[model samples]
Target chain A: MLRLIGIGLNPKKHMTLEALEKINDSDEIYLELYTSRIVDMTLDELENLINRKITLLDRKTIESEFLVERSRKMKVSLLVPGDPIIATTHIGLVISSIQNNVEYEIINGISVQCVVPSILGLQNYKFGRSVSIPFPEYDYYPESVYNFVLENRKLGLHTLVFLDLRESLEMSALMGIDILLKMESMYRKDAIDKNTIIAVISKAGSEKQRAIADKIERIKERDLGPTPHIMVIIGSLHYMELEALKKLASFPENENINLL
Target chain B: MLRLIGIGLNPKKHMTLEALEKINDSDEIYLELYTSRIVDMTLDELENLINRKITLLDRKTIESEFLVERSRKMKVSLLVPGDPIIATTHIGLVISSIQNNVEYEIINGISVQCVVPSILGLQNYKFGRSVSIPFPEYDYYPESVYNFVLENRKLGLHTLVFLDLRESLEMSALMGIDILLKMESMYRKDAIDKNTIIAVISKAGSEKQRAIADKIERIKERDLGPTPHIMVIIGSLHYMELEALKKLASFPENENINLL
Candidate 1:
């Protein structure tokens, strides 16, 4: 039997009781962290809670069939960060499991997509399709994200931008802002402008989780601590939403003259 | 101190350890079921788990300062269904708490919005603005949901329609489909037609979770069973998503000629 468990944002506090029971039952447990990062959770703490040693599944090991072989022999659990069971790679593995007739279960986690908008007091219903800002490596920069924001803006819907995270390199909110600014310079479609206001959420779902809103230009230079941050481009704002940001975090709503 | 605790989808097993710990620590505990529902969880089970007397909050009492007055004195936990912290009403309460000089914390949950897409194996990024179909009263049928679906279809984005839930009424997937079909007949828009394919998810995130996909006309008469069902009007089906639905549950892919 194989279980794909969702270990939420803060591993120690956010993982559900059901997830904990599954972790305790599994004979072999593996944590996949390449897709996301847990800022507050340590392996020692998780080990103490589950009372079992967890093997880290890196890019190389994940490519191997150690997990599949173990599933055939014994009960195995693959822990993914922030509700990744639906991810393409995980879906492929599940399909493989079904073809091989290996039973499996998906324990849903507290997805970051759900938490970020909520934490910032933005109505989740108003959000359009979310986009990811990939690290511009090897002179390759995808302007698709700008197009997404443009499409969302056209409909007066908010866009949630997830920063890309590579091996040992987590993109910060500032970096993501820089990329968007650069994309704006290239496209010049008026999707991203200096006068436009955006929300930068840092260390989301952690104790240090913070939401800051300001003009695009000012927010681009702000250093928002440890990585795995999310940036939200505001297409339209309700009065209560702006007030929520003002009350909950540092939002320079008054400074953004282009909001109108 | 105040804690907006997220008691997840299934009351029996979905809530996190952190939520339980906070519930134990708080002097007052309240469960707000107005926003969402836990299908299989009983009040007894929840109260037994936390070992505290749980108070229920409805719309009438939620508007009062009863919670605020209590929070000013001792630690309180407003246990919300799914994730209530981001909820507008909950945010209003939190704002009042801050004004009253009360410290609060937001504990996230396994939101249905996130899990439905995950369980259906649809990429989370493909979803556009979510729509809610209010239970139409006498001569109050709203066609806003059709507009949402129309807009999403324009961008080839999936529309997640949340069926409205009232105290005495729990809108089922069948009812939501009926409303949409009624709208299509009234508006004569091509957005929702007999040929449109949709995915119906019943009791999502629970042990008895079920997902089915078929044409609109076929699904309208299909009895999905129980309340609190989510309907997804698929835009562009990715190969992996269609495959996941084909493999996981009863999805009549071939029956829909218009799917091509």
Candidate 2:
């Protein structure tokens, strides 16, 4: 039987007991690192924690023929960061398992989309369509993200912007800031003004996770001190939300005046 | 200091180590049951597992004056099911804390939005705005939810429909199916016909969690035997997604023929 186990977003301890049990029960364990990464622990740490030698599966190994065939014969546990099915690639694996007649089970994990709003003091229902800003390819970046944020602004909904990260390379919060800044400029010149509120959340689900709220320019200039960050550009704020932004996020005094 | 901690969508085990730590560190833990209920564990079960006594908070306690004053003087943790900020009431509390000058922190949790796509074989990025279908009020149900789903269909984006739950009741998968059936009639008479794929996810993030995909009418007729469920009305399906839906969701061959 094939198993899709969510290793969660933070570290080894973030995994559910049932997920851990499934990992221990599996004959072969494969870890996928492309979609999301564990911030607090290493492969060695996970190995030690789970007491099993795990084979690290990159995108190629997962999509390859050998792994697919092997999964059918053995009880294999494919560990994914965050929830297993969040990425389309993993969904493809499940589909392949179906075609191959491999029985499988999926174990859920903590998702960053749920984590970001809580860390940033934004309402989840108030959020619009989430957009991921990937590295610009050949001076061609999608304006759909900008349009989404603008639409959210029109409806007074918050926008959660997930930044791009490569498996081999570390992508920092600065990348997210740069994308937001560019998007702001492309959408509206005064978008980064004092009245604007943006929350920079880094290392979410990790022990050292940091969430700070400020104007777009200030957030851009500030050092959030980590890779794997998400930004929330808030639109309309209720009286309580405005206050939470001020206290938890350190909203500026002048900004508070306008909000009040 | 006031802290809003998300216990995730399922059970006690779904919480991250950091979230667990925050819950342990708090002087008092208040759980708001009106907005959402934990499908996996009871308050007593959580108390025994976490080794802490949890105080239950109603809507009045969360919105009234006592919580604000109590939060300021003490380290308070407000426990929520799913992500803390997903519900409007939690956002109101965060705002209240800010207005009262209470220092606060948000401990993130896993949400169903991130979980649904993986299990149901839908694209996370291809989802439009999420809306809730409240129980009929004064013989007039809002068409806003229908419009949202219709718009999502037009845009080829999936719509996550949250079924209404009574404040004191446990809402399970069967309720979700009922809502889907209601929605199908409202949108299109033939919408509930065979080949119309709808995913009914119940007790997500918990060991007892279950997901099934079928026609809206069939799903409604079947006894799903659980609560706290959501419905996903799929739009355009990718090849892999379609396969996953068929394999993982147990779609009948006749249903596939209907789609063709």
Candidate 3:
């Protein structure tokens, strides 16, 4: 049997009891950190918390058939950061399990997508489709991310922007801000500008989590500690939502702003 | 201080360690079940698991100043059925905390929105804004829910439809199908029909959870056990997603399907 379990944000405290039980029952456990990083958690600390040896799987090993093959013979569990299967690559494993006739289960966890809205005092149903800002390389920047934001804005829904995380390279909120600004310059559609309001949440679901909502220019200058940050582009805001943003996210009061 | 803690779907096995610790440290722990129900677990079973007496709060009490007033003097935790703050009423508590000078923290959990996609092997990012179906009353049926599903479908995004749970009353999947059919007749947008493909997930995140995807007509005939059911209206499906649905969700192989 194979199980894809989510270890939420903080490995020390965010794992569900079912996740712990599954981890304990597995013959071999693997932890995948290429898709996301756990805040302030070392592999050794995680190993100690569960009191089991964990084999770290890189992207190549995870996507390969090694896990399926192992699960066919014995129990194997892959501990994912945040919710399992949110990353498309994990879906490949489920498909492989089916083809190989290896029974598999998905154990859910606290996702950043859900946590961000709760922490920011925003309604979850008010969020539109989430977008990811990939790290732009030479001649390889995709504008679909910007277009998705526009589509969400047009519907008066907030957009959760996921920063890029390619193996060892993690994108920070500052880097994401620069990418958005660059997109604005390239497209000139006025989708994003220094004056546009955005919320940058750092270390979400952790004790050190900090959220700051302000215009692009000032928000980019502020210090939102640590890695694994997600950004939210505000759309329409209700009066209570606006008040919560002001109190919880350090959003400045602007009398000219319109409310839904 | 007041902390809004999410017990996820099943209180027995879905809570994080942070949730347990906070519940233990809290001077007063309250569980609000009027919003949602815990599958196969009684209130006594939950109280026994936590080894503490829990005070139940209804909608009126939960929205009232009672919680904030008590938290002002001692530590208090409201054990929510799912991820805290998704209900919007809980956001009111956060706003009240700010007004009453009480510190608050949100401990995130595995929400149904995150869990349903994983169970069905659908990509989370492809889901648009979620909508809820209310129990239709005399002269008070809302077509906005139908419109939201149409909007999501236009974008080729999956719509997670929440079944209405009004205190002591729960709307089942059969009832939801009837309502959607009624909406289709009213709108004439061809949004939903007897042949439309939809997925119904019952008792999600629990041991007895079951998911089935098929034509709306056939799916409604099958027995999907218990309350707290959620429905997903299908959109464009990736080839792998279709394969996963077939293998995991009992979706039939249809040659006349389009893949993205």
Candidate 4:
């Protein structure tokens, strides 16, 4: 039997009792580190907390079905940071299990996508399409994500921008800002100026997680002190949202508050 | 000082150690049931678990400035089910606190909006606008939700339909199916066939929570015990998503597997 367990978004304590039990019961534990990571705990920290030696699986092992096929003969727990099914790639593993006639179970955990919005005081329902902004490759950054944010704003909806992070490197919020600045340039010549409300959230689901909302330019200058950040672009704001931004995010005076 | 404490989607165990510590430290704990609820535990259960009595706050107390002003003078912890800020109304509260010069802190928790999609194996990024389907108002059901689903489908996105539950009422998956059938009828003339792929998720974030995927017609006929349910109308499926649905959701094979 194959088990897909969610290690949750942040640290070892974020895991539920049931998830912990499953990890202990499994003969072999494999962790996929590509899609997401626990900022509060390293693999060594997790190993010490769970008291089990876990083998780390790279993207190739996850995508190529190398471990999944072997799981049919052994009770293996595939640990994914956050909820296992949030990423499309993990869903692929479940599908391969079905094709290989392997029975499996999914253990749920907190997802950063959900935690980010909640931390930033954005209503989950009011959000439009969520897009991932990939890093610039060979002097090229895609405009599709920028266009998506632009269209969502036209419709008076908020946009959640996910930043790309390499598997081997620590995740950072700077990548998210970089993507936003690129998107802001597409908006207008003065797009990166202080009027826009952008929230940078890091280490979501962890106790020490931070969410800061401010003008895009100001955010660029602040030291967020972390990786794995998500940026939110607020198109239109309700009176309350504006107040939260002003108080928590330090919204500057003279900025348009008549958005509602 | 005002404290926004998230009680989480389930009852007491769902609350993190940090949240529990804050609640214990507060002079007054007020429970706000209007925004969301705890499915796994009741008020008495929560009280017993926390070893403290909590004052219940209605929508009026939250909306008006009475609670906001009162909180300024005392160490008040306003308890909200799920995360504190996923709802626009909660953000409004934060704004109000700021306007009144009330120092406040937000203690985040697991939200169903995020937990549901993670359990259902749906891509969080591919979801469009989320809408709540209120219980049929005097047999006059609104078709706007159906139209939303249709539009999301056209965009190849998923729709998360939150089934409405009255205060003090127990919610179940059957009510969710009823709403879906009503929605299905608006799209087609027939008595809402059951073969459409729909997921019935109940007690999300709880240990014994349940999730099943089948045709809407079949789902309606089957008995899903208990309240706090959500229906997902899946549109275009990626290869991995389709596989996860079949394995995890138990989706029927007749549905198209490949995207053009």
Q: List runs of model 3 lying over 4 Å from the truth.
A: A188-190
Write down the worst ten-residue block by lDDT for model 3 chain B. B248-257
Model 4 residue runs over 4 Å out of place are A24-27, A64-75, A100-103, A168-196, A202-210, A214-226, B24-30, B51-57, B61-76, B136-150, B169-197, B203-208, B214-226, B257-260
Best by DockQ: 3
Clashes within 3 Å, all models in order: 0, 8, 0, 11
* TM-score of each model, paired residue for residue: 0.95, 0.83, 0.97, 0.82
For model 3, residues B7-35, the per-residue Cα lDDT tens digits are: 98887878899999999999999989876
lDDT of 3 by residue, A83-153 (tens): 99898899999999989999998888888877888988998988999998888888566788888887788
* Docking quality (DockQ) for each candidate: 0.70, 0.50, 0.83, 0.46
Which lDDT tens digits does candidate 2 get at residues A1-260? 88888877875546775677788889998898988888788899989888999999878878775556887779988888877877777777777777777787877777777667666666666676777777876865577776766666665667777777786665566666566567676767343455567787777777787777787657666667576777787877776666666666666645643331
Q: Residue A230 in candidate 4 has what lDDT? A: 67
Better of 2 and 3 by TM-score: 3
Model 4 per-residue lDDT tens digits across residues B1-260: 88887766875445655577778888888898877778767788889878889888888778888667878778888888877877777777777777777888777666776677667677787888787877676876777666666656666677777777677764465766676676676666432355456777766767667777776656666555456666777666776667666666667767754452
Residue A154 miss distance in model 3 (angstroms):
0.2
User: By the lDDT metric, which is better: model 3 or model 4?
Assistant: 3
In order, the Cα lDDT scores of the candidates are 0.80, 0.71, 0.86, 0.71
Each candidate's fnat, listed in order, reads 0.70, 0.64, 0.80, 0.54
- For candidate 4, the lDDT comes to 0.71
